[model samples]
Target: MIRTATPADVPVIHAMVRELAEYEKALDEARATEEQLREALFGERPAAFAHIAETEDGEPVGFALWFLNFSTWRGVHGIYLEDLYVRPDRRGGGHGKALLTELARICVERGYERLEWSVLDWNEPSIAFYRSLGALPQDEWTVFRLTDGALGALGAPTR
Candidate 1:
C-alpha cells in the first residue's frame, strides 16, 4: 500500500535517500538532513511532499518525494518527482510502480497536467523502468542548475 508520509517517517526517508544516492554513485551529494526534510515536508508552509510504500504488514519498503512545479505553457501545475526509491532488496515487488501510481492518482484528482522527473543517463535499469511506464525522454532539453557558490555569486550585487 502507498500512503502519505507523516512526521514519523522522516528518519527512514533520509536513510533511503542516502541509500539511493549511493546506488547512483553520488552518495556525497546527498547532503540533506532529517531536519531539513521534516521542515520542507511538514512545515507550516510546506514546499514538498512525500508518500511511503508499505507492505501489507505495514513495513515501509519505498518512498516518493516530490513537489509542485508550474508549467507556463500549460498554465497548470505539475508534479516534479525528486526521488522515487525502493530498497534494493524490496525492488521488483511493484513498490516502485505503486509509488508512481499514487502520484499519478494525485495528479488526476487535483487536475495537475504533468508528472515529471530526471533519471541518470547511465542508469539503464531505471531508464527502462520509466519507459515501461510510458514516460518518454525529453532528449532535446538540457537541464542546468546554479548552486552553492555559483548561486550566491549570481545573487550578489555587481561590482
Candidate 2:
C-alpha cells in the first residue's frame, strides 16, 4: 500500500533516509534527525510531503519525499521528487512504480505541468527504471549544484 505519510511515520522515514544516504555513499554527510523530519514534513506550514510504502498488513518498507516547484515557462506547478527508495530486499516488486504513479496522479489532478527528479549518473538501474517509465533524459541540459560551503562562495569565483 502507498499512502501519504503522517506525523507518526517520521521514525521509519528517517531510518530509510539514512539507508538511502548510505547506499548513495553519503552517509557521513547526512544530517537528518527525527525532529527535523517531523518539523519539515508535518509542521504548521510543511516544507515538503512524503508517501509511504507498506505491506498488506501495514509495514513500512520505503518512502518518497517530494515537493512542489514552479516553472516560469509553463506557468504551472511541477513536482520535484527529492528521494525515492525501497529496501534492498523489497526490490523487483511494484512498490517503486506504484509510488511514482501515485505522485503522477496528483500531478494530473492538480494540473501540474510536469514531474522531475535527478539521479546519479552512475546509477544504471535507476536510469533504466526511469526510462522504462517513459522518461527520456534531457541530454541538452546539465545539472549543477553548489552545496554546503560552496554555495556561499558562488559569487566569489577565483582563477
Candidate 3:
C-alpha cells in the first residue's frame, strides 16, 4: 500500500534513505538526520511530501519523495519527484510502477501539468522502465548541482 508518511515514519525513512544512498554508491552523501527529516516533511511548513509502499504484512518496501513546482510556460503546477527507491531484492514485483502510477494520480487530482524526475544516465534499466511508462527523457537539458565541497573549495568568506 502507498500512503503519505508521518512523523512516526521518520526512523524507517531515515534508514531507507541510507539504504538508497548505499545502493547509489553515495552512502557518504546521505547527510539527513532524523530530526531534520522529521522537521522537513512533517513540520509546520512542509518542505516536501513523502510516501511509503508497504506490504499487506506492514513491511515498508519502497518510498518516494516529491514536491510541486510551478512552470511558467505550462502555467500549471508540476509534480517533481526527487527520489524513488525500492530494495533491490524486492524489485520486479511492480512496486515501482505502482508508486509512479500513484504519483500520476496525484498529478491528475491536482491538475498538475507534468510529472518529472531525473535518472542517472547509466541506469539503463530505470530509463527503460520509465520509457515503458511513457516518460520521455529531455536530452536537450543538462543537469547541474552545487556540492558543499565545491562551495568550500571556492574559498568564499563566511558571513
Candidate 4:
C-alpha cells in the first residue's frame, strides 16, 4: 500500500536515503538529517512531497520524494522525482512501481506535462526497471549541478 508520508515517517525515510546512497556507492553524500527531511516534507509551506510504500502489515518499505518543476514551453508544472528507494530485501515486490505509479497518477490527475528523474548510467537494473515501465531516457540532455562550494561561490555577492 502506498500513502502520503507523515511526520512519523521521517526517520525511516532518512534511513532509506542512506541505504540508497550506500547502494549507489556514495554514502558520504547522504547527509540529510531527519529534522531537515521533516521540515522539507511537512513544513508550514512545503515545497516538496513524499509518499511511503508499506507492506500489507503496514511496515514501510520504500518512499518517493519529489517536487514540482514548471515547463514553460508546455505551460504546465511537472514532477521532478528527487529520490525513489526501496529496501533491497523488499524489492521485486512491485513497491517501486507502485510508488512511481502513484506519482504518475498524480501527474495525470493534475494535468502535468511530464514526470522526470535522473539515474546513474551504471545502474542498469534500475534503468531496465524504468524502461519496463515505459519511461524514456532523455539521452539528449546533460545534467549539471552547482553544489557545495561551487554553488556558494556563484551565489556569493561580489565586492
Candidate 5:
C-alpha cells in the first residue's frame, strides 16, 4: 500500500534516503537530518511532499520524494521527483512502480503536465523500468547546478 507520508515518517524517510545514496555510491553526500526533513516536509509552508510504500501488514518498504516545478513553455506545473527508492531486498515486487503510479495519478488529478526524475547513468535497471513505462530520456539536455561555495560566491555582493 502507498500513502501520503506524515511527519511521523521522517526518520524512516531519512534512512531510505541514505540507502538510496549508498546504492548510488554517494552515501557520504546524504546529509539530510530529521530536523531539516521535518521543517521542509511538515513546516508552515512545505517545500516538498512524499509518499511511503508499505506492505499489507504495515512494514514500510519504499518512498517517493517530490516537489512541484513550473514549465514556462507548457505553462503548467510538473512534478520533479527528487528521489524514489525501495529496499534492495524488496525490489521486483512492484513497490517502485507503485510509487511512480501514485505520482502519475497525482500529476493527472492535479492537472500537472509531467512527472520527471533523474537516475544515475549507471542504474540500468532503473532506466529500463522507466523506459518500460514509456518515459523518454531528455538526453540532449545537460543538467547543471550551483552549490556550497560557488552558490555563496554568486549570491555575494560585488565590491
Candidate 6:
C-alpha cells in the first residue's frame, strides 16, 4: 500500500535515500540529514512531499519524493519527481511501477500537465521500466545546474 509520508517516516526515508545513492554509486554525496529531511517534509511551509510504499504487513519498501513545478509554456503545474527508489531486494514486484502510478494519478487529479524525472544515462533497467510505462525522453533538452561555490558566486552581490 502507498500512503503519504509523515514525520515518523523521516528516518526511513533518509535511510532509503542513502541506499539509493549507494545503488547509483554516489553514496558519498548523500548529504541530507534526518533533521533536514524532517524540516523539508514537515516544516511550517513545505517545499516538497513524499509517498511511501509499504508491504501488506507494514514494512516500508520504497518511496517517491516530488514537488510541483510551474511551466510558463503550458501555463500549468507539473509534478517533478526528485527521487524514486525501491529496495533492491523488493524490486521486480511492481513497487516501482505502483509508486509511479500513484504519481500519475496525482497529476491527473490535479490537472497537472506532466510528470517527469531523470534517470542516469547508464541505468538501462530504469530506462526500460520507464519506457514500459510509456514515458518519453526529452532528447532535445539538456539539464544544467549550479551548486556549492558556483551557486553562491552567481547569487552574490556585484562588486
True-structure lDDT of candidate 4: 0.96
Candidate number of the best lDDT: 1
Q: Which residue ranges in model 4 land beyond 4 Å of their true spot? A: none
TM-score of each: 0.97, 0.93, 0.92, 0.98, 0.98, 0.98
Question: Model 6 segments beyond 4 Å from truth?
Answer: none
Q: Write the per-residue lDDT of candidate 4 for residues 7-119, one digit (tens) a residue.
A: 99999999999999999999999899999998899999898999999999999999999999999999999999999999999999999999999999999999998999999
lDDT by residue for model 3 (1-159), tens: 888888888898889889988977889999999999898898999888888888888888998988999999999999999889888888988888988989999999989989999998888999999999999999999998777989777777867
| Alpha-carbon shift of residue 19 in model 5 (angstroms) | 0.6
In model 1, which regions exceed 4 Å deviation?
none
Task: State the displacement of the C-alpha of residue 42, model 5, in Å, after optimal TM-score superposition.
Answer: 0.5
Count backbone clashes in candidate 3: 0
Tally clashing residue pairs in candidate 5. Answer: 0
**What's model 2's overall lDDT?**
0.93
Better of 4 and 6 by lDDT: 4
lDDT of 1 by residue, 1-159 (tens): 999999999999999999999999999999999999999999999999999999999999999999999999999999999999999999999999999999999999999999999999999999999999999999999999999999999999997
The C-alpha lDDT values of all candidates are 0.97, 0.93, 0.89, 0.96, 0.95, 0.96
Collision pairs in model 3:
none
Error of 1 at 86 (Å): 0.3
Provide the clash count, candidate 2.
0
Clashes of each: 0, 0, 0, 0, 0, 0
Q: Which ten residues in a row have the lowest lDDT in candidate 3?
A: 150-159
lDDT for residue 20 in candidate 6, whole number 0-100: 96
